[model samples]
Target: MASRSFKELSFVSIFFSTLATSYLFFPTVFANTHVISIISPLTLVVLDIQGDGFTAMEYVYSTVLFFATSIILFYVGITNFREERLFSEKPLTSRLADFVSAGVSRDHPHLSLFLLAGFTIPFVFMAQMLTLVLFFNIPMPLSLVLLTVSAAFIEEFAKSIGLYAVARERPGFLTPRNLLLAAVAIGSGFLVGEKLLLFATLAQITESIFGSVLFLSLQVLWMPLLLHITGVLITGGFLLLWGRQGYGPGLIAACTVHSLYNLHFLMGALL
Candidate 1:
């Protein structure tokens, strides 16, 4: 089998990053930026944490924002996925039933169930990152390490769950790529929503619809999408390997890699 070239991965990374950066320059994005700082209504969570809060509140608020963004982005992503037929032909794990969750329409209960759970996995994982940093009083390096490990763990956990459930009941499943597909779908979905909401900060202040749209357009176009995509892709690979090596061994290896990735940032912070 041909290994994926670094060029291929780099291209994937650049493509998403560029798409996001493009929105910044559109003439109207300038106005949208003004609006958000001045006028947009803060979500309840954001509002609640706004003043005289503990330093930890900043982290907590960020965590809540992640959830809010993940919800919208994931929604937009799934909507786009359904329309685009975004499943891969290859399954990370040959055993994972790629068809079960995806076989039915977007409205299917099974699909919805998986979608909900898939999102929660990442949301919880990210929340844990902040929790570890703040409440647990772990050092920044340790928190970062835990964050990466948790991210990988969540991805693998979701895939294995999908694989087992689908392959067990369905025969000759329709697709072999459900787990990765769903995770990416959820991640991209999170990106879309987060882009708009976060960037909307500027546009909301201006109270101009046109500005709002451009802020969104610019926000939706890039890096966050790549981050979400790359992160999911790697996680999928780890999970596939885990399934092959036996669950315990696979989980440890995956988490270690993930931990190290986060440690890069965490250690710097600590130093």
Candidate 2:
């Protein structure tokens, strides 16, 4: 009876917690309303200054959007702070890979380079497809993404750096699952930033309630999952190769890939 009552209380707590989360953390409805309310005035401003004005507005809007989007992720991270302990637990010698990853003298530089090329090369193929689409002027946005896709090759390799970093810092976090979690956690932070940008844009641009919700949910799930895994792969690879060589190379590789993905679209805009 006591356990049953406790379970009921837990359920009620979770229900209310989720409801509060929705109320507090949700930006979709508010963002949409704000955009709709402001669009006419914004449009007027845009007509006066045209491209420069629009660009400036975008910067402001993007910043606002990112802030709102990050709020949700921050809330989630705060709630899940206990999960981070997963990185702090475990036996020492079992983390031999972690030490090697942290830069033990016994590691090889070439192995690191090989890790980079391996993760990056597959992404290069994806980028090639993107480049091909761009060259042909395909209707798909894929063309605008070639450069970013190209960088994926390096990004996945860099995920291993997180493992090495945490391992060097704590070592037992070298397991594949924990490594994946770290990537997810870090990537969630990034996606929250992305979610904010998307929200701000949608708030400014669209009004379809069902469509917007679907879009928001999909973006939140898919992009983070893909990105986190990418981090895991690259960083994980480096840890495997260098063990305790530390994560400098892995980090460089991951960031390189990330830069490629975002820059890929940027290149198109410039062209």
Candidate 3:
């Protein structure tokens, strides 16, 4: 066991060391500054008025926002899971954990179901960066539209991957209600994680606490929060009903709705 652990740690250390070395020397191997700015909406000319690291106030605000939203979403998901599985013989805590972890229950002290759900935040940001860097100059309006459309696919696919892994580990637990609840947990995790990461990323670029705060506030208050939940539910429902048979209709529906939701912002950006 110790030998295996040492090997794993050594591999990780080597991988990161190589990545850092490559990044330092071949920074342009990935996206350039122009492409980065385009992909990151907050780095546009408007909000990036200041140019410093995060202010103390910005840190506090972001922390509060992340935790507050996470707690609400977490509680809601767990509560819903408990209610939905009321007839099941499984204990509420185990059921809740299974739902949050997408049908698998591992015995890890440090890794909670909550943390597993939240993993999508980094996964999504990295995916977005890849797309933006590859297709940099695709026109702003079109880019936004494409982004929204593609994000639906990417996010659904990612969720499917998670579900597949967990289900493979522990089969026969994925029911319709459980799938829906799991989707909610994953989506809630994705939403909060994405928002917090975006805030920090924008803060780093613009150095403007106000801009970061405004962007986050708008997302949490108005359309984005709802849109995120709706998209995930729609996709989850489709996956629950017919995903194993086929996922075409679900993917299209979710993508279309998500794109439509993003239209307002795209138009605003253009005009």
TM for every model, in the order presented, reads: 0.38, 0.33, 0.53
Per-residue lDDT for 1-271 in model 3, tens only? Answer: 1112456558667875664343233313322343233333233322245443434543443243335445655664664454445444554334433454443345531133335546655545445444544444567546655655665567655544455445433555457666666666656665666666666544442233212212322444436656655665666566566644435576678768766655655456446
Per-residue lDDT tens digits for candidate 2, residues 165-243, read 4456655555766555555554554344435444545444334422232122233377545755586667665775677
The reply for model 3, stretches above 4 Å from the true place, is 1-103, 106-114, 167-172, 204-218
Rank order (by TM-score, best first): 3, 1, 2
* Residue pairs in collision within model 3: 52-207
lDDT of each: 0.41, 0.43, 0.49
| C-alpha RMSD of each candidate structure in angstroms | 16.8, 16.8, 10.9
**Model 1 C-alpha lDDT per residue in residues 190-249, reported as the tens digit of each score:** 455444444432323213432222222233356445544554445445444443334455
Which ranges of candidate 1 are over 4 A from the true structure?
Answer: 1-118, 121-130, 133-135, 139-144, 151-164, 167-171, 174-183, 190-251, 266-271
TM-score of candidate 2 versus the correct structure, residues matched by position = 0.33
lDDT, model 1: 0.41
- Per-residue lDDT, model 2, residue 162, is 32
